[model samples]
Target: MQPQSADGASRDPTKVRRNLTYDQCYYHPAPLTRVHGQDVRTRSVRRQARIARREAALPSSRTAVSTPASSGFLGSTSYLSVFRETPRLSKAPDRSLCDEFEQWRTKLEYAAARVVRLASAIPFYLEQIRWYYDKGRFTVIPAPIVLDSLSQTVAHMESHPWNVTGNWASIYSDLMAATKSPLEISPNTSARQFNSLFTGPHLRFEFIGFIFAMAGLSVQGRFPGRQSLELGNGEKMDTDAFTTEMVLACHHCIEVCKQNSHVNDLTIWMRYMHILLATEVLGEPSERVYSLFGDLTSDIYAMGLHHQPSDHVPFFLAETRKRMLAVSHRTDKNLSTAMGRPPRLPHRYCDEALPLDLPDESLFEEKDSLERFLQRLDDGGWNRDGKFYPATLMRMRHILSNLREQVLELSLGRSTHPNYTKDILATYKFSQTIFNRIPSRYMYTSSCWKEMDAIECLARMIVRLEHLFSVLQLQRIRCQENSEATSDLLDTCLEVLSIVVDLTGQYNIHEIKKQFAWIYLLKPRSEVIRTLSFLVSWVRNTVTEAQPSVMVGACLELNNVIFKLLDDALNYRPPLGSGQEDARLRSVDTGQSFEISIQGTRGDLPSDVFNIGLASGESLSWLDDLDFMQTSSGLSLM
Candidate 1:
């Protein structure tokens, strides 16, 4: 078969090609001048000598390449002797196929490397932030110093992202190029060298693990810290910072692999989701990640339907998805799983898992880094991009759908054998653990929402299941009761359903409303509040005036709905547009003031206790009134 060039044109048919062996391949760059060429060559000799010494370590009669020396120097002329003949062609050789695959693999390896390299940096950064926080000096660190450090780090990472991409691309090109030559490789060849190129070396696999750790640590630094700051400031909700940097990173990785048609693109993309999911749990959600996830989900289905020849790719994607589900489950069981199931744990994010009593470390590090990054927001100046940042719900819909398919795959025992229910529960439970760390109330901002996406989703899901189960109970109770009780329970159940249905159906939330906190995102907070208020007033009116048992039943239903709503509202951070100042605060009296140290504690005690006392002696009374129980108990208990 004629060879094809890089651009897919046929190679000159008249030219005689050299028959290259694996050894000759390395020596092609005569007098190899790469920076580590000599060192690498020297290492090769040592490896070969060790192999010879431990010939007993080698399997008997397995294929072995003969390394030939030229000019008294040894090199990587190694190969599996079994593949001496050219690969048997089931179809005519399409030489360019080698070139294409080579290009794809090279890019993929680079993307993977970027993720890996970032992994290497995480432990260092995490430690740095925690130290400062412990000293009560995280925020006190000069912003400029932090900026300088970040600028350097980000720049270095940026430069290398492409570098890694290029290296992987080159490796792929070489591999494909090798495939086209008479240097045939066997499917079952016991060549350790060959396996390194495909599955990667021990370090490479370690890099993958490192990537997972890095992703987890990225938010660990910022999430708890930011929440702490916000709580101290009396802001109950954390803002979502699923910023452009993260979105762009996901985009670059996913898009590069897609463009190059990288074999492991799906694997990298799936791993990337773990980071995104963690980020989302922390409060910021990545539109690009979510969008890409949707596209990938659809692509998987398309491949399955078409019986696409890219079986290996799909298999990797599925496996990656499973791995992600597994990692996320580990992060927090009570956090919502991608699959809809009961949460196993009550919370997902916390500091307890860190070196003992280091709850403030993640937060301290994140704030140090983020505040610096945030300062740069003004460098280029802000300009609204005349487009809506898509609501996170759309992304969740796609993710949940993919998860559903995965669950089914397990349930039917069609793909791999595993317990579907157990897996789902595991993920759900893990997510819940993560959510438990998020401060309740408006102490966190919608801007920091990415940190708790998984947690918020878990909370929402919990609320949902709780609602569903309660509704079912209500229905059963209704069936067993007299008409009055039955009517009351039925109404209550419907109200619960109405609220849940509204929350679940936010698939196409309005553009303006999309950015709100999870609680507000459940439904228009105003509408829900209004409906609730009217329901309560109606009940109050009934209590004062004579009404039929049916009306009394409606009142019971209304009361149940109010309780559920209160559980959600009082429990969740206020929505983004709620326009409610986090009532949590510390106040300085007009004539008197006090100083307090933050000391990295995670609560509103300092701010609340002080502020209320300062605002007025009556402020303490006001605090008592803010409790939901107190608010509900007086006169309008319904």
Candidate 2:
């Protein structure tokens, strides 16, 4: 065999194989190789410069303060070390320092708990505000009651502040007394003690309350024309009371949330806003909502301001949107991100769909005239709209009559991409669904409305299937280049078509058989011959693979369908002595055979007669006697 270059020029196949070209690029690269070797050094220098700039920009207090080993949550160990050159501070001397630190730590914990509780109530008030805004009615309950409850909740948080700092202090003291070595304060012990003090249950309740508050606020903003109220201080608010308050509150909370050291508080705040914003997007599109998007984008951008370009906010938003959309009741932030991306176009199965061009003025004229005729049928009797009614029918007929012409025009010869075949298969599948939904009774004898509906469905399905066939043809040609994968793709396309046959049901079997017959008869001109062979093989193989329970019925129905196509072929062209050589040959077993070939051996290949015609009476008895061949081969059957 001739060798080939990556671009497909003939060379030595061995050399081409050894080279293993990838993506049309040549490489004899070694491992650990850098693409921009000199740039790496420059980048490192610039990174250090930026770090220096950042450190220089820090406040004097932070710059001046460098903590000793003892400054960590664990007590200082330098004083206990045996090899230390400098004398460490004694425990007695540091006792006062430790006390002051403990007091400050307690205050921080109390502050955090207050923030969490306050944030949790945010969601609920938001909802109340939305209710008041959208309902155009305020709760009879006084504003004093709401304020009282909020104030009480805040006070409760202050009283019940988590004593995590105390717990950490106790754990450190215990570990210091228990441990023998300076480095023996195990992380596991610290984690266990921390978990004992602040469990996940507490985290969940706090986070949930925050979400409820945010949701409440968003929901409250929906009503238009709701009257605003003056608080006890007699301050008249002119703005949309709830939204304005919620937005401002959110802005303030966001700022405070920045100083939050605990990840949970920040995470919950982000989640609450996300839910609130999402709620707004669902009911209506607003300019205010667009500002929410801008804020969210800015926040994400700002968070990664000092990080690498890999921290792209849009990228995270895109991915998070995918995940958030799958879950119900996500935050306003999540919803905004979800709404950020453009909506995807509906899936297409075939390439031969209508062109991007708008339908010509003539089609519109025809549609208008058809509608007028339909109106007459609806208003006066069909007798009053005589010519118009018939004219509309003629137009319908014209549309249905052009199905084949349209499919032929749309066939995409051959494509090499996996998408080509996959798209074809998808199109085929979608068309099958629409075609199956078309009512069988309406096919041959229904009113104009019914016929038009069925024809439209049929036309669309046929167009899609045509595109699929084009893709399949292209795949077959490409198989010579990459047989293993392309062959599997072809098989998948065949499987899809088989499914189409099953969904066609009894009514559609006839129309499909006639269509299939037309295709096979057209041979190379249309993909009929290869398509028919694949279908027959699929039916035979599927029957062989069927379990004993359903095998009998599946085989009978499949054969019945096959026989109908055979019958169409028979009528189109008879047996050899039946006057036409084509007709006679069509009914004979000489046209095609199913055979298996063995590689690397000179032996006779096994053959199976794949005659598509009827056998002798005895052979036909089992099938016909089973009464499976009663349906006619027409669109009415579909």
Candidate 3:
């Protein structure tokens, strides 16, 4: 790994900077493009930076922050503490950027007419995404502002399509030689003001990527599944087609900005925005997902966003940077825990605080809008007016995500430092304190959701799951270290699994389970199953080590709860025939193996580590069918 300066990015000493060797360069240009011809085991490329400006306008008072609901689960944490301090491997960002397909390497240059055709849809795309769309904190630029920018770009492209792009290529060729300054925005920057920063007739490639990306999301939202989805242009395509089209467009536009070493909010934003989409469509252990995540983290570090921004940075840019980091960092921790891969954006390097829990609109709506909203905030900076903003969800999730990182260090780090475990336990204690402080409105309540709209109900469900999922991941590791733990694998495992079942039994998540839309929301379902299935093996192995009578009873009785839960998940579905659910449930009675994609391994476990495939047969017969388990004399099917 290339050593970084005090700031996240390091400058090259060579005659032509940005020409540093892939091994020696801490920061490279883009996530998707590689300087060297091949993928390597370690991460070496440096990325863009985020420079912020204001923090004073935000409310200084502390209050209870609100959160949203949803759950996630993890697989085994059975790997013992093998070292004093774990040599955490950073596999995610290390090779996350390489895509060596011979064909895709060629740059795509669309004709003027084709560019116009796509540009024309920007307004339509902006509207559809904004329509009842809940542009949560995840989406930084407001629909109206993006729409305004698109209108200008489209008009300019219509008359002189070749003119703008030609000028663009020549102008940016110079800036690519060395690192560039970060994009800046005042805290109170308005729609017009923001457009002035990036919008031009040249139609910046990053912004172009942003437009098409937004367009793709709108299409995805409407027809979320892989089956029978159609773009309004009258072509019927599956989810993968949409994803491929979006990804290609992202490549076409973003490749230039990246090549030129241009790291604006738009470039970084588009890269992170597309990570999950590409992962779902392409499938996980996905190189595409890595490319996007790598780009996101690379951009963050290059921007020096890991450090707290000075008051000199613009407030709007600073807050935007914070929000973006929160999203990327939260995701980094998530991928780390799920795969046991080291986190790319570790918390130790990230000193930037979570963005204030104010709506994006509050910063731009009126001259005094931010100040006014500040007064209405609860002590925790949450909006207490009974309205849920995307910031509220991100803020809550950030806290949980940070906790997830701490949990990882404790369970996986295996530190020999004095009172290391005690320090971890202390953090665990603080977790409860944090959860207790969350506002009541955002807390999960099974009885209360009946009155809310489907979307609102879903939002609240996500909040709960997010919190519970974090707790469950922590507990699974802690319990694994202590064999004396009860059958429940700590209460969180059961709770996370239960909520996942309820998603099918009680709500519409089954309806929206597509890789195309809400990948994070849909991800936990597979993760929850994976975690519980591993628990079966963990419990079975643990009980076998105990007294004979205890082992027999434990194997025969204790696992019933987990077995039942797993059984419920395998069989439950949201009554098929809508979108892709039909295919998932089709031929259930055929007694064939269910094929939900499973990836990688936890330690030296068998290649068939996860036998979660449901038999759909009566009487739990599939449990007997497991081949690898046959060797375990003490473990029994009955």
Candidate 4:
């Protein structure tokens, strides 16, 4: 049941304006220092506290240096407390709904919400997608439709693509200019028509809801002061407001498809047939996704999925368990980084091999087929001809996660403790070795994407960005006087930022990346982006008389560039004062503890954001680069 417009299309798509939290926001960048809902000054306090806890957990430093006389009859266990399970202080459990939602409108309120999270058959994962799109019943694609639309769009565009020899807007004029959906698609659509269809609104709401919004809004709308919600005047579809809004719009659409709201067998059968004709696609917006992640990893240890399965298990079942362990391990590291916590599944305790790199087809086929597939695999067990198998990325992710865990452990360790490893160079070299050892076939380049399908290409790009990002992240902690990263590392960091900006500007990759934005390093959240931005801060903060880093010159602009890129990407201009209300439901002193006037804007504080003072009387030629000017972009983000 949808509300109809004068044209008879539905109107409920306006729901995108509400429920911003249920989906990830692409428009506003996440907060840098206060992501964990802590004061900016408390980051170091938490790190020190985390280190203190670890030190208290272990035996004293005296145990490592026991004298021969002291060692006689005096063992390491002499001072140890007997192992015991005791009740400890616990914190309040986290709730997904606000204190308000405790007032559920009958069980139907929860029944409707639960339908989106659990009862839905469609997955939010990349491996499977919304396969059942229908015209009025279901706006997402039908189960039978594959990559035909993508292929047809490829056919519409000129062969010279922007990623290669041309940009999408340059080769096609209508990219930022479309005003209407076509009655029909064209292999030879004019530049204006194509751009309109390309950057213009696609139906993002479900069935009736989606149909109306696409008609009304590139996402046109009104603001608090009657200011126009303007799209950028180019092929770039990177507006933080629009992109973030559309992402939420898509999240709900996917939920509707997954919940199978139609709830019947005959309709699904008919929808499958209609896909032979056409289809479109999108997530519910929820921070609860991460909350659910915490629940999942906790349950993993409960179920002993962290350990290898019994030897008696079948190959498929054993492999599936192994794969889950690997993915969860990697996911834990990422979540810990963003949340400023320790990883749940540390690599040192886990004992299991990566899942075999075989496609799903080979596993389901006859026994000989599985064996033949195994025999043809490369020495490293990679699929031949750079083929993509589900396990291919999984295996790589496991290996990388193992290294990432170690890196994070070192970064969070008690460096001042006597037992801490002093050999930082060794850790640096180990990271390099692991990164280099990645399978050559998994290396990604936009040019080589022609050989593989979209998922495989996107997967390769994702892993590569992750590899580079982790390297820079490790550098932030280790890039000190004696163990500095070379200029090449800075080059890679710069490349990462550029690629991220360019990604927001592109159509094809941007759409795919937005779907799983919360997880992917390329589509990394605020905290991860800060790691890249703060590399210069790390270099400067180092207490050293050692020669200034070669990167210091380039780093002068790093702060502004990083903030600008993110500010534009996430449309992250939040309210200035602690008392001011955030458009987002979150309540972090997210805007920082700024003192503001009666007006919503800043008054006491100057426009200059960072107040940096150098100890030495060096000429700061790039002082102007640090000017943190605020943009006019609206505030709406995850």
**Among these predicted structures, which one has the highest TM-score?**
3
> Could you tell me every candidate's TM-score relative to the true structure?
0.27, 0.22, 0.61, 0.43
Rank ordering of all candidates by TM-score, starting from the highest: 3, 4, 1, 2
Estimate, for each residue in 8-85, the C-alpha lDDT of model 2 and write its tens digit: 654322124335432332211111112244466754453333223111321111122422322221111111321122
Cα lDDT over the full model 4 = 0.39
lDDT of each: 0.31, 0.32, 0.51, 0.39
Per-residue error for 33 in candidate 4, Å, reads: 34
Model 4: residues with Cα > 4 Å off, grouped in runs: 1-96, 99-291, 419-423, 481-489, 497-638
lDDT of 3 by residue, 31-93 (tens): 333344443532231221100111111111112231111011222232211111223421122
Error of 1 at 228 (Å): 12
Worst 10 residues of 1 by lDDT: 69-78
Native-to-model Cα distance after best TM-score fit, residue 472 in candidate 1, in Å: 5.7
Hey, what RMSD does candidate 1 come out at?
Answer: 25.4
Candidate 2 is scored at a TM of 0.22
lDDT for position 629 in model 3: 22
> Candidates 1 and 2: which is better by lDDT?
2
For each candidate, C-alpha RMSD in Å? Answer: 25.4, 31.5, 15.8, 22.9
Residue 155 miss distance in model 2 (angstroms): 6.8
By lDDT: ranked, best first: 3, 4, 2, 1
Task: Report the poorest 10 consecutive residues by lDDT, candidate 2.
Answer: 629-638
Error of 4 at 20 (Å): 29
Clash count for each candidate, listed in order shown: 77, 40, 35, 27
